[model samples]
Target: MRNRILILLATIAIYSCQDKQKTEQDNIIKTIAEDTLSKTVAGTADVSDASPTEDKAVELIRKQLNVLLKKDLPAMTKEDRFFYYEAFDLNNDKKNEYFVGFSNSYFCGSGGCSGYILNNDGTLINSFTVTDFPILVTTSSTEKFYDLIFETGGKFHLIKMKNGKYPSNPSVQEIWKGETPKDNAKVLDIDGKKLEKYSF
Candidate 1:
């Protein structure tokens, strides 16, 4: 009778451990699913062909770009100057917007780039000039907009788009860059390492 009771207690212990393991597995799976869903919802561009309205807007945008580039425009085709092109629903309006990157004529050297977010109508929403390439952040903010990340001069920087516009500042010309000139708290590396200053 004593031996039987011991065996029963061991079985209960094994069952308890198995249940705890299952619960942990479920939690991990749930977390992964949530993260993936968020990325997919924000990252999906779903663009096949431009509609008539988008076509017209694109042409007008090209023309405006030519005007901006002026003499240099003749040399740089859309494919040449435009480095990145993507369409995503950024503003949560259920309509996709354009995220474009152009080789910056203004900021040059080893690492210089420009970013733009255009409305569906091809109107200029916001523009940014960074040291390196601007990457799309695959998540929307709780404040109800998307983010763009830049790694310039080895320092990680962020630009937030609230209704397709960056904050109006001439110095940094980006949102959420850093609080003070000497502040290093905001910067991060690709490997999530903290850095001393901005570098390529």
Candidate 2:
């Protein structure tokens, strides 16, 4: 009888230890699951909070363009009647800023178009010009200190904000001249030296 009792006690001890181990394992899993759930909830909250500001910025840009279009159409030819806004990290602030460009029927020279940077409040920050109509605009880390390239006039024009203003020195070198080739897009240094060329 005593032997049976001893066996039963040993069995109980082993069972108790197994139950404790199972409970600990379950607790660890639960903790991991809760942490993952928390991260997901936080990520979703961040996106939801960010979406409204993004939407508002887009809406403001659209309104500004609409006003410009309505007011400037009378001054623009049919071919010169377009304006566009681009978003980029012009100052490397990590927040996107605006570059507004417009075609002016009034400008007669090769650089007939103008551009401006817009503040977050939709106000014009500075006025700048390009050598021609901009077919495209992009950013690169190679030229501009912040790695921004304003592709216009058959070349990439490095633009940056200096002294709380856009670079106003009109004495900068004209990187490219003549006409853009149909097959190759060329880049040049500020001294008019060729850098690289690639097919569009």
Candidate 3:
């Protein structure tokens, strides 16, 4: 009778450990599923052609934007919280760079609105004080970063990387006299109605 009781106790211990392991496995799978879903939802862009790397870049950029907006404009209304972003490989590197545009009045002016260029890791590469949509990515590059062309005051300006950064203000950049390149990719050209609201 004593030996039987000991065997029963051992069996109960084994079952308890198995149940605990199953619970842990389920929790891990649940966490992974939720994380993937959140990233997918957060990274959904208006343009459906985004690649996997681009989607990851968008998710990182969104997190950075959320932090900035929360810190700078804590009182931002729903309209003020809208932003547009596009991820493109500026160089031949596999990593993609991000272009984010803001329509909030605080970030805009009579000339144009503010735009930002961010590295794949969500570091600020550059910021434009007065810039407009349809930003052109030229076939040519400088400092390993592609040159950008954008219009302001009815003239197209070519922005090049100088001193390890693009010009902070596009209004003062040199005007592009050459014809627009057929292969240039347009960034942040989407309609404002499609802008994604801040996740924060």
Candidate 4:
């Protein structure tokens, strides 16, 4: 009878140990699963939060700009950064123009950022030194030519196309109706002071 009692106690001890081991294994798996879930949620949130601002405009021009310029994304996005706000028909013509901004200190001097206008069909249009993007583009009534208006050093530089290029010596239109700010404007509200047809 004592031997049988000893055998029963030993069986109980082994069963208890096995049960504890099983419980431990289950807890480890649960812990791992919970940790993985939290990490996944955090990663998704990070991308979702940042994409709207930083990624939206860059993404629109990234692939196409790289292909057009014959460069990779990394090279294009270096310290000399390029960005665009919108593409619009500035001249009331059917063709749209994309206004590009350049940064990294060298591009913009006291006049704010340099602007480039590219046609939607990927043609290089006229560019001007703009306090604001596209400061103002004067288009011919028939849409045959373009005139880019920009301010530089408190002066307006009216750039017209000459031989398909904005000549190094663009006609200077000193159309400052009021005191021209020595620096670039923070927004796109460009002044049309001396830009009337009566002037040179």
Candidate 2 — which residues are off by over 4 angstroms?
1-55, 62-81, 103-109, 133-157, 168-200
**Model 4 lowest lDDT segment of ten:** 191-200
Task: Give all TM-scores, in the order shown.
Answer: 0.46, 0.40, 0.67, 0.44
Between prediction 1 and prediction 3, the one with superior TM-score is 3
Kindly indicate the candidate among 1 and 3 with the higher lDDT. Answer: 3
Q: How much is 97 displaced in model 1, in angstroms?
A: 1.5
Q: Model 1: per-residue lDDT, tens digit, 75-107?
A: 664445543355667658988776555443643
How does model 4 score by TM-score? 0.44
Candidate 4: Cα lDDT at 104: 40
Taken over the whole model, the C-alpha lDDT of each candidate is: 0.55, 0.52, 0.80, 0.52
User: Which ten residues in a row are the worst by lDDT in model 3?
Assistant: 191-200
lDDT of 2: 0.52
Q: How far is candidate 3 from the true structure (C-alpha RMSD, Å)?
A: 6.8
**Candidate 2 lDDT by residue in tens digits, 1-200:** 99999999999999999999999999999998888788787863222343576566656665665554566657666556444555555546677676655544553246445655677777666666554433223343333324234445446454454556655322263343444334432222212332111110
Indicate which candidate wins on TM-score.
3
Pull out the clashing pairs in model 1. 153-198, 153-199, 153-200, 154-199, 154-200
Better by TM-score, candidate 3 or 2: 3
- How many clashes (backbone atoms < 3 Å, residues ≥3 apart in a chain or on different chains) does model 1 have? 5
